[model samples]
Target chain A: MITVSNLKKEYGTVQALKGISFSIAEGEFYGLLGPNGAGKTTTISIMSTILEPTAGEVNIAGYDLRTNPIECKKTIGVVPQEIALYNDMSAQDNLLFWGSLYGVSKGELIKRIDEILHLFGLHERKNDKVKTYSGGMKRRINIASALLHQPKVLFMDEPTVGIDPQSRNLIFEVVEKLHQSGMTIVYTTHYMEEAERFCNRIGVIDSGQIIAQGTLDELRKSSSIKETIAIAFANLTDELFQKISLAWPEVKRFDQTIHFFTSNSKNDLAKIILNSNELGLDIVNIEIMKVNLETIFLSLTGKQLRD
Target chain B: MFQLAFKDLKLFFTDRRAMLLTFLLPVTLITLFAFAFGGIGKAKNEVKEYDLPVCDLDLTEDSKTAIAALDTDKAVHVVMVTLEQAQEDVKKGNKDCVLIFHKGFADSLLYGSPLPVELQYDEAQEIQVSMLQRALFTTLAMVPYSNRNNAQRMLNKQFDKLIGGGNEQLKAQVHAQSDSLFKSVGKGVEANPKTSSSTKIAIGSDIKMTKLVEAKEENSPGLIQAVAGTAIMMLLFSVAAIGAGLLDEKQEGTLKKLLYSPMHPNNILFGKMITANSISILQLTVMFIYATVAFGLDIFSHVPSLVLMIVVTAYACSSFGVLLASFAKTRQQVQGFSTLIVLVMSCIGGSMIPIFIMPEFMQKIAVVSVNYWSIQGFYDIFWRTLPLTDTTFLTRILVLFVIGSSLNLVALRMFKKNILQIA
Candidate 1:
């Protein structure tokens, strides 16, 4: 469990994190979803004891971050966005070194390393130098190193950025298994789908403030967006798109597809099909999607998750 | 802390290029110096030989004797030639000096007159001229005794001629008394060589015919100085190389990872210190062993002093490196800073050149450099061959230790203040 109350951080004239507050329960996967430079990493850094807050308090597993940093740090593991590994050292050596830094005994460290290597599926290349490893393998080892001490809470700051799909999927699976086994994890990412698919609860943060925090359904209900009807056409010209927009002023054009937002999808779906057929445009496919995190984020901040 | 240091050592040693440079660069430099300087300290006491061209126009016994003495002297290589040849050789710079014995030199000596010996020498070759002058003076010293003998013989012969016309018995008695008196005077003159010079010539009696103190046979000043200078320089380089690890870790983001652990930030600095110091000690030790085996440097006789200097120097160098690393933001910055500091210190501290030869102001500034103290401490043990308990030796070691500890504390403060803050 982690409690961050009114956390604030400043760098010179810039306020990286304002007085924002959030909490995570035990054995829950909490995702902090935001765009780039939305203070997600700053919050994570402050919570993990790597950075000091300008004016606030953070408690991890009953230990105060400011007063009892060492105790708090003992209960948390941090997987940084960048690969923070000694390229000259083997994966096993890196694990052992990190484990020792946490005061783990040699025999216990070796056993833990073996278990984590197997869990991350890096047991076969445990003895090879990290420099010789692929980007995905290196990322896996970076994550594995953090888990050596088996902390109660793990903080992963964009661990799947700039990696192949297989590695990203492997990491997702590992994170899911950890969460399923009753491990509390705080994951920060800019990917809306990942937050929706993996996080038990999501905190939508923008501009140093968390605008929304709840379950997927709860967030959808809170947002003003009701539904989005997407109609994909084989070919849509600017003239035809303008005619559709003129008929239904709420229709948004995106290349060969058009999005129609409405409060009652049942009525709008029939009307949009009739108008498109009259305009001589073939509707190749139609999808009626309810309000999701992306639409909610757009409605809240007027910007995409990656902006 | 120990584990961190051990990990650093493992990483450093596992890289073959780093290992080779840490051990090989100093040895190579020392070898090159050995050949360049014609063995260390050898230039100070080595006696150089000069060429002397001589012309004996008289061809008399006295001239032959003088030329023989000059030829036999160890300081000159005598070449007997014609007068024209002698002058030409000196003018052409083939020989440093030419000594000419004028005609009637033997007759002038027999009459107790000043002998004519002209010396033509090149003024530019002062050392060679000085050597030639000394050699010539030593060989010509015997001329006074020869003149004295010739004069005594002439006096005896003149007395015999004057008494030949008087009574035979009286003549014999007078001749015997005069001969006895002259023989006694000759014996007195031969008894003291210093007072035997001709009264007309005033070559001072204080001219030393040989060196007052001979160099010690066991120690080579050049080699020992070279070893000490090379050791300190290489120690700085090795410590800098080791300290670069800190910058590397910071750039790679591993430093932040380490901070995220339960360990304090000071543990990381202490770990790096241990690694750098250990490697420095190892580097200097290897250099010493190489010096002893290859150059016959007698370092074992002062083991206690040598060990003390090595420990203190290594500590100072490694601490200085850490202090530099604390302020550097990137690996290239560290490299530039380390190179600048090491080179300047080595230059002023008598590592690249002897301290005694430096300008007075630079020598005063040398005291502030850690390399100066370390090199001086090594010199006390290796060059001066002083005992471990000598005051100067002990003072150097203590000062070096204090300076190293102070730098380490300052570096630790800086690390806590700047590096630990996540900006």
Candidate 2:
């Protein structure tokens, strides 16, 4: 469990995090969903004791992060965005060093290293240097290093970025198993689908502020739009878009596709088709998508989840 | 091809470390070398004055005159000390040579017996010794000849006393004969240059050049200097490279991972220093062992002193490496700065060039560099053959320890501020 209250961070004249607050229950798979440069890494960095907040308080598993950082660090593990392993060292050696740093005994460290290597399916390459491994394999070993000490809470910041699909799936499965075993995890990523699939509760963060936060169903219920009418145009003119925008005031444009959010998709789809015909616009494709995290995020914020 | 070259050139120019290494390092080295070798605005004929210690046991006026003549030379300044003090100074490497005038030196010079002057010197300072010998020979040659007239006067007085009131003619003839012989001998050098060259003038005819502290026959001054200087200079380069490992970790993200651990930031720096120090100690030991085996450096004779010096020197050199790492922001910057600093310090501090060969001011300035103390400590153990309890040896060790401690303290503060605070 973690409690971050009114957390604020400043880098000179820029405010990275603007008094945002959130909490996670025991054994909860909490996902912080945000676009790039959305203060996700900064939040994780502060909570993991890699950085001190400009002004605020964070409590991890009943230890105040600012006051008792060592205790807090003992309770949590961090998987940084970078592959924070020594490339020149073997995976087993790297795990042994990190485990020792966390004050793990030699016997227990060796056992845990073996277990984690087996879990990541990297037992065969344990003796090989990390520099010789594939990118996905390296990412798996990076995650394995953090789990060697078996901390109560784990902070994973985009652990699956740039990895092969198989590695990503394996990581997801392993993390889900950890969650099932009652390990509270705070996962941050910009992938909306991953957040929906893995997180018990999702917090949508953008521009250093959390706009909405809840379960997938709760988030959908909270969003005003139940459906989105997506229309793709071959060549959409400003005049046609303006007219279409005037017709449906809640319309949003993403490249050549214009989306109209509404509670009744069938009615809105007919209206949009007639409007495109009246404006002499060619519609290439059209679809009515039911409410999901993407639509809910687009409804809550004007931009897509990735943007 | 041109486009590729231009791309590389642009990248090189954008890299400040590369630019500094290309432009600034060579210029700095040239300036330091130029200043140390031929000082700025110094006259071409100006020579370094060697300090020569003298213990005049005779204390007679003739001995005084001899010492004064030697002191008057522009090449050497005579420092009068007791025999014990003079021997201690030369043995401790404070002075390269000592001139000891025995108790009967004046009597021997006046009576035309064997001259009684001894030149006690350290054989390790081969160049200084040769220069001193040349200057001393020219100066002391005047002492015996200048006293020729006085020798004639005392002979006439002795003739007056021994032949008083009897055989006036015989005494006068004998006095005239002795006076004529003294005049001929005095003017014989000026009369015929070739004969004067052949005729030994007996300038301290028995002057002995005694080696104050004899070392093993296998050890030569050049060999010792080369081994110690090269060892120290290379040790610095090695430790600097090791220190740059810290910057490598920072770029590689392992440092960030370490920061996330429960260990203190200072512990990471300590770990780096310990690694560098251990490597440096091992490097120096290997170098010394090789020197002993290949060149017969006689290291086993002074093992305790060598070990102490090596440990202290390694500590100081490794501290220098860490300090350079903490000051630089990147590994490239560390490389550029360490190369510049270590090279310049070596040239100034008797590694690339002996301190005695440098100008007086540069020799004084050399003490500020870590290489100076490290090399001097090695010299104390190898060339000077100082004992473990020698004050100079202990001072060198203490100074090195202080340098290491001070640099480590500064590195700790900088590492916390520049590295940990931002990690």
Question: By TM-score, who's the top model here?
Answer: 2
Candidate 1 Cα errors over 4 Å, as ranges: A231-261, A267-286, B1-218, B420-423
TM-score for each candidate, following the candidate numbering: 0.69, 0.90
lDDT of 1 by residue, B1-423 (tens): 999999999999886556545665456545534533335444576543445677899999887876776676676667788877666544433344667788887876675456677776643334445656776676575554445566554455556676676567876776577678767866876796567543333232112222111123344546766888888888888788788888888888998998898888899899999999999889988998999898887777888888889988999999988888887776666776676667667776778876644433556677888888887776566655557876767888999999999999998998888664543
lDDT of 2 at B102: 93
Query: Number of the top candidate by lDDT?
Result: 2
Residue B7 accuracy (lDDT) in model 1: 98
lDDT of 2: 0.86
lDDT of 2 at B11: 100
DockQ for all models: 0.56, 0.76
lDDT per residue for candidate 2 within B1-423, as digits (tens), equals 999999999999998888888898899888888887766646576766777889999999989988987787788789899999888877877677789999998887666565688899888776667767877887776667656675576566567778888788988898899988987886886788687644444333446799996665577778877988999899999999999999988888889999989998899999999999999999999999999899888888888999999999999999999999888888878888888888988988889988766766788899998888888787788778788999988999999999999999999999988864455
**Which pairs clash inside model 2?**
none
Candidate 1, B391: how far from true, in Å? 2.5
**lDDT string, candidate 2, A1-307, tens digits:** 7999999989889999998899999999999987777888889999988888888889999999978999999998889888988888999998999899999999999999998989999999999999999999999998988887888999999899999999999899899999999999999887777888899999988888998999999999898999988899998988778988887988888789998899998777787788798888889998888888888877777777677
Clashing pairs in 1: B40-B222, B40-B223, B41-B222
